[model samples]
Target: MRPGAIVIASSLLVCGAIIGCERDDMWEQPKTAVLGTNEFFDNDQGARMPVKGTVARGADNLQEDDLLYRGMENGKLAERFPFEITENDLNAGHDKYDAFCSPCHAKSGDGMGMIVQRGYKQPFSFHIDRLRNATPGYFYSVLIRGLRPTQLPGVKFEPDDDKVHPAVAHKLSPVERWQIIAYIRALQLSQNATIEDVPMEQRGELDKPKTEGSNGESH
Candidate 1:
């Protein structure tokens, strides 16, 4: 065969090979076809299998509920949790509160934290009778789920891997969160308590002791 004819044949062979190598459906226009058993089988066969024991997407069984706000497992509400509020728990809660909540709720729980100082809206004071009357469960719910901005603007916090956010807006571990509730209760009582509510002997502890300096003026 002539060299030129040989070259033309080689080019045609290469072109055919290239066309064959292209994906089967690449050049074909998409067709609207009714679902068929074989097509369904093919689609499912190619689909990624879900990890073992993976719950279905959007399943309510996997949802964290208000029960978890108290750190109790769902369906086990009657059972007492292992952790309880101790003085140490309260202290740790105070630290966490100062780090996360003090920005908005303020150190005094008066809804006048530093954010409000910069012209942000203030939160309700924990000392309010309405708030003081609320259950610890209520506080836990608010802290864990966060108030929707549409419902109560700028109050939401996102949860983390343990399903607890480091901030008040995320879900906290049951015990640590309850400790925060205990501390808030203490703050409310301190600000809004009657003398009769206090024990008579311990009432003296509420007053500050007089301090005299070298200048003889009370400090």
Candidate 2:
């Protein structure tokens, strides 16, 4: 046989062996078809049942804490916060309030936001005695379910009226809602605080004139 012919035949055999191995791999590759029978385990399900009590990632727990998740302590609304508010938490709450609540409720929580100025319905001021004294759970309910005005147009709301109508909906997360509520409390304190409410050290700071750049003002 010619040297070239032998070389060609050897190359063909090598190519054929490579193709055969690939074919074998294709046939023998391990993967179970969906719902197909498998004898590897007893009860033979190709799709194995998840291990008992295995929770999927990011899945909400079925047994959620009422105070933490729903802001309820008993059958009624909770008066206290679900978690303790730290200074950092307050700052986060302030940021969230500015981003979401300020457009409608205003940065001062006075219900006179830019939106209200633009003819949108003015919501109740957060500093109102009714609201300032409201339970945390009441605020949580309003944040989650939201308030809708049920009274007739131009009808003024009395202090004793049921103003928190939980009909409108908002999409804030529970934590974010709680944070905004904390900021609202802070705003209420800042707005209505008496001279006695301020610490002597802080009182002096308050009396000091606010200069340019005192509150992010341009120099």
Candidate 3:
């Protein structure tokens, strides 16, 4: 036999062996031995795997322990926080209320904000019987979870994007939330006050402060 013919025969034998050993199961459908949701093959063997964690839509995992309004330590509501009402808290609450609540409830606690001026449905007055009689727990629940929507215009939309929309987590801490509540209480008292409640001399201080320009001239 010629050397080239022997080489060709050897090559054919090697090719035949390679072809015969090749697995044709790559395109085959996976066989289900156990017909259950959790059963699946990994590395050609059945295995159960845990799913990964993901952020819920519109919700943020705020560190509650670090929050100012940390709910009860032993899973009970702390009706009275350790902090007392200071001038600083009142000031901070005033500023925060203006930024957040004032858009819906005006400075006077009347539901006549700019949105209402533009034809948005006015929210209920804070002095209303239901809200006025609400406990701190009720206020906190409403502020945190928000009210349910009953009709065409909803009170507040459900948070779906933690990034864009401001959740209760983003706005106020536990302490700050309480501070705002205190400030609201103060507002309510002031509004409900009679002539007997106001001292004659100190009443003048309640008037709006005069604004002065850089040159000390009133605009």
lDDT of candidate 3 over 1-219, digit per residue (tens):
999999999999999998887564764445544533333444444443434675544342445552234434454443544467898888787777777887767887877888777876677777866556655554554566564443214233345412111236457766677677777767777677887788998777668575554342111
Worst 10 residues of 1 by lDDT: 157-166
Q: Which candidate has the top score in lDDT?
A: 2
Error of 2 at 193 (Å): 0.6
Q: Candidate 2 local accuracy as lDDT?
A: 0.74
Question: Which is better, 1 or 2, measured by TM-score?
Answer: 2
How well does model 1 score by local distance difference test? Answer: 0.62
Model 3 steric clash pairs: 58-160, 68-174, 68-175, 69-174, 69-175
Error of 1 at 77 (Å): 11
What is the TM-score (0 to 1) of candidate 1?
Answer: 0.51
Per-candidate TM-scores read 0.51, 0.62, 0.52
RMSD of each: 15.4, 10.1, 15.4
For model 3 the local lDDT of residue 87 reads 85
Give the per-residue lDDT of model 2 (tens digit) for 1-219.
Answer: 999999999999999998776554677567777898777979888888778979766432343677766667887788898788988878888888887777878888888889879977778888888788888887776665555445333234575655443422245666777777787888889999899998887777876787766683121
lDDT of 1 by residue, 1-219 (tens): 999999999999999998888765765435433442233444634344576989778443365653544434453322333356688877877877777677878877998888879977666778877677766655765676554434433233233312221235433455667767778877788788799998999889879564455342111
- Model 3: residues >4 Å from true position, as ranges? 1-82, 149-167, 200-219
How well does candidate 1 score on lDDT at residue 120? 71
The TM-score that candidate 3 achieves is 0.52
